[model samples]
Target: MTTLAPASAKPTPSAPTAPTLEWVNKLVSFDTTSRNSNRPMIQAMADELAARGLSPVVLPNPEGTKANLFATIPARDGSVTGGIMLAGHTDVVPVDGQDWASEPFSPEIREGKLYGRGTTDMKAFSGAVLGVLPEFLSRPLLEPLHLAWTYDEEVGCHGAVALVRELDAWGIRPRLCFVGEPTSMRAVSAHKSSQLYRVTVSGLAAHSSMTPAGVNAIEYAARSIAFIRSLADDYRISGPFDESFVVPYTTANVGVVSGGAAVNTVAEKCEFEFEFRTIPCDDPKSFISRIEDQIAILRAEMQLENAAADICMTPLGAVPGLSPQGTRAALELAQALTGNDAEETVVYATEAGIFQRAGIDAVVCGPGSMEQGHTANEYIELTQIAACEEFLHNLAVHLSTTERNEQR
Candidate 1:
């Protein structure tokens, strides 16, 4: 969780840069797991961008432990107003319990597969962007091109929330954005919304021998967990579904849990983390409203057992679903770039929706696959990287060829 802040003094600008493959390996070496601070990685990238004569802005969390980076490559006319923004989160999921074929943070390659914790999930996309920086710079762009590398995306897209605010503050609006989120080099036009939460329960503790003397927090927590499962089952049987999604309906899952001291002791507290991935047609507010009602009832039930007992649910973060309404141009551009005509959608969430919420058309298009992301021995086929590079190349060509006044 340790992070170093960006150096206060700016360095002299330089044009020398590394290749995309080297950038991918270097970025993967940084362990930016959700629980850790990504300030070091953000600062390093900022320095590189700044040295290349591009002004990159570093936006940090309230605590200043982590940060997001935004930079722009203007058109031949030196205008930074309307253009395309390429974004990717710098964070990777933890590799704690998974057994990797090679060191998780140390990048390795075997038989055309790059092995690393974030090789497939995100760093590859970000690395490929860095790799193609010069290509974007060399072209006579009609509109500006932007890079938005963010933090805490593995958690709840929190850093992107901040990035949106920062963009508004700077009065910068890109024509659209491409959120590179391991989509197998395809154009993804829609995805469900993702919301995360944590719940905690407290009760009076006593010896296990005298169950009547203690309010069992763990037992109370189980009641709420069961309630969550029941809601999931209810939606599974209901019809407010979007067939475009793989799950085709809303879903809830409790991913982590912990509590208690020992088997011989009555548990005084219990904590659990859960999330709701709601289809675009569903309302997450209604879902959270139901959860809050259940929390109030559970608190009352616990209080009846012991005056000191308590139960509470805290919202972690949320992102809205991406729909096709505003993505016409972005999808077309993606299709033109990748030469994929099929309309694709995913159940997983991405930062694309966050950008769309800011009135920017956004789509999910990137290298790698969800099958490889967040798994042991995570790797992206070298061919996927090649495809992404070609996609970027085509994008640069499109921007370079667009008329300055047309404003795509």
Candidate 2:
């Protein structure tokens, strides 16, 4: 009879494997949700970079609760200028209401897909860059390879603004930037701009029975929202359409509204949040100006009813769109590396636009699909990871070739 191992005896636990997968697993285990601090993840990445003979720079938010990381693998001569940048955000959207088969933060692989909150949204691409770090360091290259990881990208690209400013001041601009934002590794040349704002309406509170005595804030707010919808309708029927985008034209929506204390009382204050996804030809500030015109009329009307009545509008965020005309170099490089002949555009917003505004040409190319991002049981296919690895390898080879040519 063949001897069998005891039931409780387990094969020596397999040593941690899949450096890329390991990085993804470790990153996913952290709940770096948009509202949560991402310092831990940044620290972990900084430690890994340091171990690889890199001096990672950390730019912390004023609160010191969040951070952005920038590290580089210099050229053979140790010069760190005019290189390619791989950029991704560390923050993932919240999983509060979404149902999931596995913990969103506890990564699980099934059917050749890794299920996790950030796996598809971005962390996979970040993992791939870090996974191929050794290969990048091993090669003698003519240009540096910079890695940029930011925080709070899901929250209107707030962190990237400061990070970009810092990079500009540091004078280490990259020749091109690849923003890894779930395009299934295809090169995306353009995307719409996102402009979010909130308006607060103020009125005098009183019992609902005395309707004439108090300014009804909610009623006024409803009117403003209707006007915004009308503007959206106008865009839908307008001629400034770009057929490349699914929406084609600019769009607006009132996403949130809060007012009224109770059924019997007139609301003293009302607050509403609205956004405009504008096309490249449209100026977001123009939207703001139009809204302000409407608000002025509302304010004038309210003042007639009650001199104390008022309204205030504040800009929450405004991220510019990446125009294809200025992104030719980035497009060509991404196409060459991925062997793709076609380019595409997206309706969604990304930090790529912000980077472009900072004078760095940017293209969106990464693993997984945006359709899978921010959804229940978010996942990325294993094959996508493999393809991403191949892309990184090709990038290394390309840089190596450039180095060789210069040396000759």
Candidate 3:
């Protein structure tokens, strides 16, 4: 069974004040899965920020079912210069199909580990930032520190895009950003981008005996899928050649395919969802265009047999890759704060790329391991929270020292 943290319980400072862990526990208690609404959690966070005397800007989606929160602690001298942004997502992946030893929504601590959905895949990082608010507030800041938490990250990098646009509209640009994704306390300077495409094939349905008289949508879909597989093979051979990533190259896969109603009937429709994780240097559009070109050729051939035969491709979402920025100063600061140097890259996508694209030198660095993210019994070690507290402490100290220097 899932163990939910008591929402009303005040955190004890003597209990090591793992603010991030406490925050993560509170976040996990809410069922903020990608398919469900995350407004409640966002509102809670906004209230928390307000209570800390920070004014939070809530950017809500058109439907008002979700939101992204952005807040800034201004420099003491009232300078309008760019500052550092700490980013994290408010939404988590679904736990519907996963088996678990405890309720995924209820956070539980066992043997120095906290287990719950979103514990590592990043509520912990957001919580950590919130947990350290007291210290951050107490400091005299030289440069502003911005906090940005977005929704719908699991669906795509959607919420952050909106938040970034809002910031742009307001003419608020940050110098650097730290995306607190699960990096096991290391700094990640790069990650592959994800581009998703959904292809739909429409054809005339007919009896199996008259299959030749009707175009088979399923067969056409199979041809497209085969071409995609061949493309994947070519990319595997060509290689992105990065030693940091596990695959070391762009990878494409068709994840879902659906069509047909009966065994004796000629299928009239087929749809498949495919995605490619492209290296930073690779153009995702080039691969997508290849698939489109192949589909066009196939459609032309099918049209010769049946004028109604058609194939269409629609883009679901595309997240840009994070290119390596030489010797990131933000990363160096994070390392000094955390006292760990285990830097690396990852195959999974995150909003880090978006921040980098917005011209904010960005790095992914935070607590916990990706291995536990989005899995059954998802967890973060208690020690990771302790380390994060120390990191935030160092950050606070750095802010104070920098403020002192600026005063002189």
Indicate which candidate wins on TM-score. Answer: 2
Put down candidate 1 lDDT per residue, 265-312, tens digits, no spaces: 899999999999898878899998998999999888888888889999
Worst 10 residues of 2 by lDDT: 1-10
TM-score pick, better of 1 and 2: 2
Clashing pairs in 1: none
TM-scores for all predictions: 0.92, 0.94, 0.93
Question: CA shift at 22, candidate 3, in angstroms?
Answer: 2.8
How far is 397's C-alpha from truth in model 1 (Å)?
Answer: 0.6
TM-score-based ranking: 2, 3, 1
Instruction: Please provide, for model 3 over 136-176, each residue's C-alpha lDDT reduced to its tens digit, 9 standing for 90 to 100.
Output: 88988778889999988887889989998999998999877
Model 3 Cα displacement at 90 (Å)? 0.9
Worst 10 residues of 3 by lDDT: 1-10
**Model 2 TM-score relative to the real fold:** 0.94
**Per-prediction backbone clash count:** 0, 0, 2
* CA deviation > 4 Å runs, candidate 2: 1-17, 403-408
Clash tally for model 2:
0
